[model samples]
Target: MIVSLIVIVVIGIWLMSMYNGLITLRNNVANALRQIDVQLKRRHDLIPNLVSAVKGEMKFEQETLEKVVQARAAAMSVKPGNMKDLAAKEGELTAALGRLMMLKESYPSLKANEEVNKLMEELTHTENQIGFSRQFYNDICTKFNTKQQVFPTNIFASMLGFKPEELWELPADSPERENVKVDLSF
Candidate 1:
């Protein structure tokens, strides 16, 4: 009887620990996603100011500006997923933004404007931060998913109803982002 009681107690403790670990992992994923949203919001806010600043100088690039706006709209509508859809939209938006930046290069006055320069700088910094935050989120999701699928943890995960998280990713076919690389030769 005493041995049975001890076994039960041990099992209870183990289950509790597993549950707590899963909760922490899930929370980390959520927090990381929240961080991305925060950075994305900042990026979105900067877009209009950027567009407005360059509009006058970039008179002939209306098509490029429209693409940027459309891409932003698409990105704004993206939802969470571990698969291709989410990543593709993100890639598209990033590519469009890349195009917009390249267009800016042709207009020296726009590039030289104080407000445009500052906003561009902020947008660049925010994009870097968003990328870092996304990596962190994916890492957390990987850890959680691995734990949920592993042997002992898998049993506990199943018992506790833990499931894998969808990864937050950029669009899969964003050729634009791929082409936006700087020429580092200099």
Candidate 2:
């Protein structure tokens, strides 16, 4: 009887450990998402200043600027949803920013302007930071998802409503347009 009781207690302790592990994984995923949010906000804060600085020099690219503005608004207004939808919206915003940067290349004056140049440099740095944050978030999601889909943890995860997260992937053509091929080979 004492042996049976001890075995039961051991099983109970194991289950609790599994449950706590799942909880920590979930929290890590949430924290990673929060990091992405902070990076995105930094990007958003830089946009208007960029747009205003380039507005005059990029007069001919008004449509591109408008698209960036609209896309930013759309991204900002995205409703709470599953990770898949959120990831898709993030891709859309990335595409919009890509277009804005492409448009920037057309204005020689804008490129040379000291203030605009500084803001552009900052924006570029912020974009890189956001990309890093996104990778970090995705890595956390992978960890959470792996545990949630595994054997004993899967059972606990299902019971606790833990679900897989979508990877933050770039939209098709996002990278293609963002980095234009400059044929430097002579």
Q: Which candidate is the best by TM-score?
A: 1
Which ten-residue region of model 2 has the weakest summed lDDT? 172-181
Give the TM-score (vs. native) of candidate 1.
0.85
Q: RMSD in angstroms, all models? A: 2.9, 2.9
What lDDT tens digits, residue by residue, belong to model 1 across residues 1-186?
999999999999988888898999999988888887788778888888888888888889999899888888877777754336556766677777877877687788987789998988887898898789889999999999998998888876877778898887544455643655666584
**RMSD to the native, candidate 1?**
2.9
TM-score of each: 0.85, 0.83
Q: Candidate 1 at 79: error in angstroms?
A: 6.3
Question: How does each model score on lDDT?
Answer: 0.81, 0.78
Using lDDT, give the best candidate's number: 1
Q: Which stretches of candidate 2 lie above 4 Å from their native place?
A: 170-186
* True lDDT of residue 147, candidate 2: 80
lDDT of 2 at 96: 74
